[model samples]
Target: MKLKIKNKGDLIRLRNIIAYKVFKNSTKINKFVGYRIPRRKCDNYLVKSLIDITQIDASLIVDEVNYYGKMTMENRFDLLGSGWVRYRCDIKDDFRGQYEYRGIPWNVDIKTGYRWAADYLDENDCIHSPEGVDIKNVWELGRMNYLVPFSLHVLSETDRELQMAALIHYRNVIEDFTKNNPVGIGVNWVLPMEASIRISNILISYDVLKQTDDKDILDTEFTILIGQLVYSHIKFIWNNLEKNIFGGKNGNHYYSDIVGLLVATGYLQNKNVFTKKVYNYAREEFFKETKEQFYSEGGHFEGSTGYFKLVAEMAVFGTAMLIRNGEVIPGFVMERLYNNKNLAVSLRKTNHSYYSFGDCDSGRFVKVVPHGRFLSNSEAESKYLNLDGYTKIYGKAEKYFLEDDSSMDSLIRYTDGLIANTKNDTPSLEAVMVYQLAGKRLNYQKKYTNGNMGAEQNDKKVQISLNLEQSVLEKYPIKKSTELIDFKTQNKLLDFTLFSKMGFCVIRSDKASLLFRFGTNERSGHGHNDTLHYEYEVDGISHQKDPGTFTYTGYPEKRNAYRSAKAHNVPYYGQEQREFQGIFGYRTADNREIVEFTKSAIAVRYRNMYFEHIRRIVIRDNKVLVEDYGKRDFDIHRKMQLRKSPAYGVIDRNIET
Candidate 1:
């Protein structure tokens, strides 16, 4: 591959690449023999407590785990548009499989074959889908999240035969992957972020498996394979840490690198001089980055809800592992994580879902798919009230409650319970592990009345309740357990709840909810040009939506369009809010100032170099009025950016982003 230096950022990144290559060649690192699974040390009381709390269906877990034995998975691909595709693999093969999109292989370039070394491929180039490739499809399988379901089954199942089958499948997968993909080669190793994610899932899977007390699964060979895989991932992440060395804000990729290193080093069995150095380096960076990356208000600096889920998971799990190892976590870390949970609770709708304001790839440290909910719940179409009537097609509405939200909910609930030593919802095996590691009491009682996955608040629920109440100030925070005696008809006033540092203002009542994205226009990584973008819902039905990101680099035009200001529910000018520098970054800036906000009305102003646009929204008698004002000559378009993206690589249609 030829090097193309377009700007200063590229040059600085190239320098780091060169430096990493030299270090890898010059240093002699110690070899990792194998790892001892930490689940073997789990408390029996904690395991049983989680089983009862989650109420996981044994038969469903068995069926899902068996599917992995067939090496088949059902998932959605954004490149091909809607619908889930079933991917079947052969463990005997070298893992060069591909999903055909429009009769063309998605991950494999017909000419190059995909065995290129990490140094050969330029990740930024999208050189035609047929000739090049989108590497995320391969990375998805490499994540190995399916192993988690199998591990959970092994823990919950009673039949010996079923447990054995799950164990066999798990061992076969490890053997196949480690045997085929060596220490460093192939598309799977193209990005260390993938390696980091894979490491975390692998570690969690095996930790749960070891807790099953099944010698058949925790044999010598299995331990060795797991050790080598983890060691390789750790070394790769250490050598290729995604640091923004040239002085810009580091995003989730770099955070994942630190998390991968920290988890691997902390849990690995064989620790030596080299491993100690790696652990220390990762530990130091983890704390510093956690403080810098997140605002005090507990929002990630990237201004994306999807990225917030990712970084939050990393911080929580990393903290849990440290605390388990007798390390005293700083108070600030706990406070920040608490605030993150509060933010998550604040953005949640009455139905327990969140709006996708900016870019969301469904990225998570662990992919928790409970009760076989592979696909999320969505509406076919939503309607909007216009000049004529409520006849305008608003857009496709989607609710993302399964994928990463489950993992976050479990972590937040357990973290609160762990700190306060109270009851919590142990929704996943990992959450149970976090609880068991801390020796927290399992006083959890299932309250199906809440209807929110049986989640209950602990004694330290003051912050969370306060945040939720702050969003809807007229009345107490609505709980599913509360009797809905004509809630929609109640005339309750909802004042605006603003997180000034994070640039999000929310107005919610019993029957209507509105969210606004207003902040400085400049965004670095995983940001969409959505200044003054807003989403409004009436009677729990979405009327306006933010066109979420469909793909990053698969198609450049689509990437630019989806993140542009025109792809949102806002007053768009002829020009974009910021200039797109590359696939992820931006140049130039704009300003969004909130002039006035109240219970009944709100006004916001957007300013760029060219002109200024002001928008005012008022709510009266269950009716909304949207008024836009701008320069006399500057034309404004109130275009409804209505593309629905529930997850990464998934969109409403193939024709659009």
Candidate 2:
């Protein structure tokens, strides 16, 4: 027989095949059974005793509904008593409605979008629909089942009846569906059964005590029906695990991870019926996939800083829990956690904040949680006492702290020693003596506009010095400047002015001197673009020029231009880029001062004399001296000149400690 080719028919067949494959691949069946003490046996049992003392009916408590309308019920509550224990109760309503039997408000409705799988249902009826299937159709067929019922037998009588009606309505829906169909495939239909059977065994004797009550019959019926549902669900998960792990989907790593999480949660809760062998298999499968997700740097391969933190935290917690339970933790888990912790520590700044390297998620800068707190929920509570309060605390312990360091100690020691020198009456004019004696301060405001070019090359490679006290200072009221006159003329004083602003200082004398600058290049060229260029003091005369100018674009062609050679005081005589526009030179004599202007190589042959150069000279007890070893000739000439203005702002003597 030959099949006829038709468009819609072919599409429908393909769709069906895809749907079948998805269902076959995705099916997981597992039963989670809970244990608790019987109601009558717990008259003074911690959790049950509270219910009795509070006079609340345990049966009327309602089941919670998540935002998606799925029902959720907890078989036990954490009692605030000395020890924690679980107490079992039966559902009075067949559907295990929102309330316990005595009508107490047993459940809370969670309005947020995040919810567990069992939250959706109208009592025992499941609200979730099958893949490729209509929800309405599933509802019509009565395949969905109610979630586990919240037992309110512990709540007060007044609240029990109030909450009972809602519970009954929910139970009726489940009962109706079960009556019509014996088998179903929804989360609600499955989980409650396993929970019920396990809970029933604990309540065996209590059943006889409540036998006379109508509520007892409904509870028993609900319990039995739920047990069947749970059995079926567990069978599904088990069968699927067996099929898939052995030989099923070729690449479903996500599914495998989910299965591991589910198995772990069940094992921790003591809800799963899996034997030791089965449980071991599930755990091994989980760790295998988890190990591969780690990168060599110990970060999650997903490349998200936030995700890495989250995953690493979870992994650490899980491993700790397993260790506490006597399970062997994989070595890779410890390695990954240690690596990530070290990386995070390394990235922290002095302020305790991390540089936002890699794909960082916001809020990562929040205080770190204590290492002990990461072990378990109970341990965390005990150590911190209050989680909220602990999170607000800053800083870490000293031994493993990121802030305390040897590097900081060294910086502190250096700065403290230097600050001491700036304190006493004797000022070390070492920096000022080497660089410049007297020159108009180069105004950076004007020089920077043209270009910052060629500034790097002019930086002095040699050192020079001067005796500062011998120099003379004159105030130019009109120019708003202070000029110093140096008696010594040495090689026309190489233009260390521009380079000195970047921190280099030239200290030169007749014997020997040194040029000292900590960092380099404060300009576009070398990198350090400091405003204070050169410094030199002779006798009482001190000349310090601010940063020099360089063309912003290309090198200056006029080597002799004021902006080029004399401006920065660099000896670049070749046809190369000039540093700045103008050069300011000063000399002082007994009665007059000489100022020289070099417009270009052609502009100034002789120095200009300024007769109004009135200046005071202070002779300190220390004699002014110059030291030069004679790499180049040193010449001292007396030239009278009016002092030019100091380019930079007034010198502030205050030094920070």
Candidate 3:
């Protein structure tokens, strides 16, 4: 959408953006070059924590690491968790900067294929082009996240032959990338956010390799080569910060750039004058964006649960690195992190999955766990249960299934490990790193009132309990043991919560769980026109589900269709809650309000431009009564033919209205 100043806040943000741009072009920040890695190495807290964690099998770690390591070596990758897609470089064992998607290579023409990152003017349009090639598929390969396991293995494993193989592969892959993808060129360098994420992973893996005992494998030449790579990434990210602050365009991308600066600065052993100034600037922006991007009530301001998990992962690692350097985390920062963790816990279903509400391309700052639906594609069912048009959104015919992602669960476990001073037998390397970086048990309870997060006045009114049988809770227990909840506890009542500011009212009972989404984000492009849309689950199975995001820029029509009101379960009156302006935003709609929310029932209303929708959901012993008090023609109980995008690229079309 074209930028419009609707409020003073918008005007102020725009002014700040102009000023920041002016300063970026005409200050010492512009004159700064980069720093090199120091020979002096500190204690590798991550490696130590991995060794200290309980119940980790040595043989399994070796096998899993080898599996992915060999896959990386063989050029096979599961991009965005959409099954394994393989591409062959024209030159064997070379990073030629060409990429592939579903066996179709794109941006392959040497003359017109890819350009220097600096030459691209309308970068977003290029990346999201409907030219039959998804840039994400290309950028995913450049992220080098697949090599993370090998990096961690070198530090923790004792097998000499295996460790040597991993070390060689890690060095070779990075060296190849640095050689081919120069400082500011190629499709890989098109976006600063991509560069930010890639550099962070590179430094993290490099950190693991540097601390390992194999000194000969990581010799002076390789270390210097890595030093040059880090310098290039830092320079590129500094020059190309995604600071298009008009109309809430800068969400996770800007946040990621700041976090990347912090990580890159943290990794620099020898800090020069220029590196020091950039580091200080990044530290200042990190805390400010925390307040702006995250809601005071604990949820991310952006509407997507997937983006929430992604930003949370970045925030947790950023916070951990800052804490490791002896920086005192501000009280407000701690409160947001803790509250976000609680929200993550609350969003977890009985089967340990979260509902994908907004645009979730399975984006992550880092990947620590090798298993989960996040890494693997959704499994197809033999027989189709085309409920709520589960098949149509995926663009398929009569086949239905939902992909599972546990990255949020991994974050929850990381927070649990931090506070409890234990890993709880979780294999998440990020969790152990956080626990070790904290240096001591974090007193999270002291930040927000008695381990609960929200405005102080509404704390009591926001949470209510409903009685459920022990058998039901046991039947669908959390897959991993986390300190967030004690399965062994005597409390048999599930807690229902309302994050008023974040606009999610969750009602739970013995029979079912319902989630109602209200509110509109003025400054976040991730907000969907899904107001008053509700998701219902019974006995740990999704009876009615929200059709998640498919592809963002690859198919603009599909992107808009997937996020429209008709795609949701709300009563459609042939008009959307808001009109779509672009792939990521909409013309502001009238905000939905909560009318009544109690133990037995929940009511919400959205006053649209054409008509008002007052949806009332009543909870009973064995069923839910969805009543819409609006236009007589609007049917709350209508068997609508909606579409659902289960995975990023996979689709199943098999239902109707």
Candidate 4:
């Protein structure tokens, strides 16, 4: 059959090609797959409600129109108002709404296939559909369900008129859809219900939908619909929380806390429906979980910095919500919140940077809330409003916390008393070490992890210093003199000797000082790859250089590597994974000790009995000394190699000075 052409020669060729295929495939598919399934009646209550409200007939509405066949007809409309209009029909499915609201006219041209129908499949035949055809196959038909009502502006109308028209159209469409109960088939059809409610509220706030004689009908209906959606979302979260917490599901309690906070905020803002009983129940559950999960030291039990921040933010928000609502805040909840804040603050260095351990976002350090915010529930919002005052308060508080020498003394004495009074029933030297290390020291700077000792100086050196006598080593059984001391201005030279009880630390002005740790019968569960790890400064940067601790559950890599022992900086020549090879008993031999003389070099030694490894470092003059002692018969094939990078200087100690 000769195809009739209207607008241009290209239009005729394209329509003929598509029409030919549609005729052929529609026949073949019907023969092979039988007739297409009829559209099922949609059971969507909301859509039905909308349709009833709009009083629109669902069946009579032309959802879509196919233009391929219609374009072959003789009748034409000037969509562009050009006398040379090319299309055969003025209102063909393809051109019907193309030029409406200032949209580009859909014209037939040859390049590749049509963009819209590139991935189009016919539900009738389970095959590709012809390009530029009104989507007829049930599968292709479902794509229309995902169409969202958007604002349209006609070129001739003013901005206000267009906006008002758009608003009326939106209301009409929403009403029609609610009454029609349209069945959405695709994943994209899942409307952003929450976003829609918020938008409707905003529109109401703008007075675009004014109250008139029909105010009760318009405003009351919209309000009830929005309320239903908000309540449904809140109820879903509440049910999930109960299932995760009380039902013993493996959901994270921290996630539960965040959801609770969100719910509380929504309720307080009058956006969600929450009963008094429900709120009380949520609060009770949150308190119970926080007390059980959070550590007294303020560290998150999950050992994740990211998770810690998430939980802390939730707690802060919850606290503010409770205070605003005139509810009583629990003491332990406040205490834990404060403790978490302190831990986060302590993790920061003098350079105002933080360690990226346990999935921490380093960039978040700049946005840290001041200490005063955690002091009282009311102050949570103060940081955002009174930033200058908050900064001053934080500065003053940090100075007092770090500079109070009397407080440090009292803490040390109190820790010593605890150690002395405790029996050896479950002797844990690691606990004592942590407690002693907990006290803040003033005028003494050291790098923790992943930081250089003198970062700002551009020297990028590693140097460190420690007060050996005042440290936790006084409680250990080993004599201080047997320990080796090594010192270096940079990484090059070396000065070495045995150290005294008043342990010394090598401090390179532009580098991190190295303090050696050696002790018997102590284990920190949160110990690093270096059981005898050295914490110091490198080029003015501090890092949690110690390899992190690990557990056997779920993480088989950690368990296989013997909790990262194979990756320790120390030498472990002959020990099997998990095998203890030293003189430590009951307690795991993980110690942090540095031996220093009155004015000479500083020697440090750390040994992990479990890994059968030792790292000995001595610092004197402008030189550094290092010795790796591993088990003599350890299997090199199974053992990990010691990877050392000596950056600054040559390692030589025998040259006579």
Residue 506 alpha-carbon offset, candidate 3, angstroms: 1.8
lDDT (Cα, 0-100) at 556 in candidate 4: 33
lDDT of 2 by residue, 234-323 (tens): 333333332232133211223233343332333222433343444566456547645755533344443223334534433433343344
What is candidate 3's lDDT per residue for 143-234, written digit by digit as tens?
77776665655555567876666666666577666545434434666677888899888777776566664547767667666666666667
Please give each candidate's TM-score.
0.72, 0.25, 0.76, 0.35
> Candidate 2, 62: how far from true, in Å?
21
TM-score of candidate 3 versus the correct structure, residues matched by position: 0.76
Model 4 agreement with the true structure over 360-443: per-residue lDDT tens digits: 211010011111112221232232221223234333332110011001111122222122322223323222222222222112
Candidate 2 — what's its lDDT? Answer: 0.26
**Highest TM-score: which candidate?**
3
Cα lDDT tens digits, model 1, 1-657, are 566764433453455346445554312111211111233432210111112324334443434344332332222222122222333332233222332211212244222344334433355542334322445555666666656655665666678875665566566556556544444434555577888888777777777666564556567656655665665677667666777832576778898888888777767555667677887887778788889887655678777887887788788777766665566666566656766766666676655556666777656676443322333223222210111111122222332112322224543554553455333444444455555544442222222122211022221111224354334332322211111222242456564555655667677776666677776443546778777766766666665567677666566677788888777755555777778887666777678766655556666667777667666555565445555566543433444444566565545532231
- Model 1 misplaced regions, further than 4 Å: 1-121, 125-132, 213-215, 369-418, 421-430, 437-490, 597-602, 618-627, 633-642, 653-657
Q: Per-model C-alpha lDDT, please?
A: 0.55, 0.26, 0.59, 0.30
Top-lDDT structure, candidate number: 3
Better of 1 and 3 by lDDT: 3
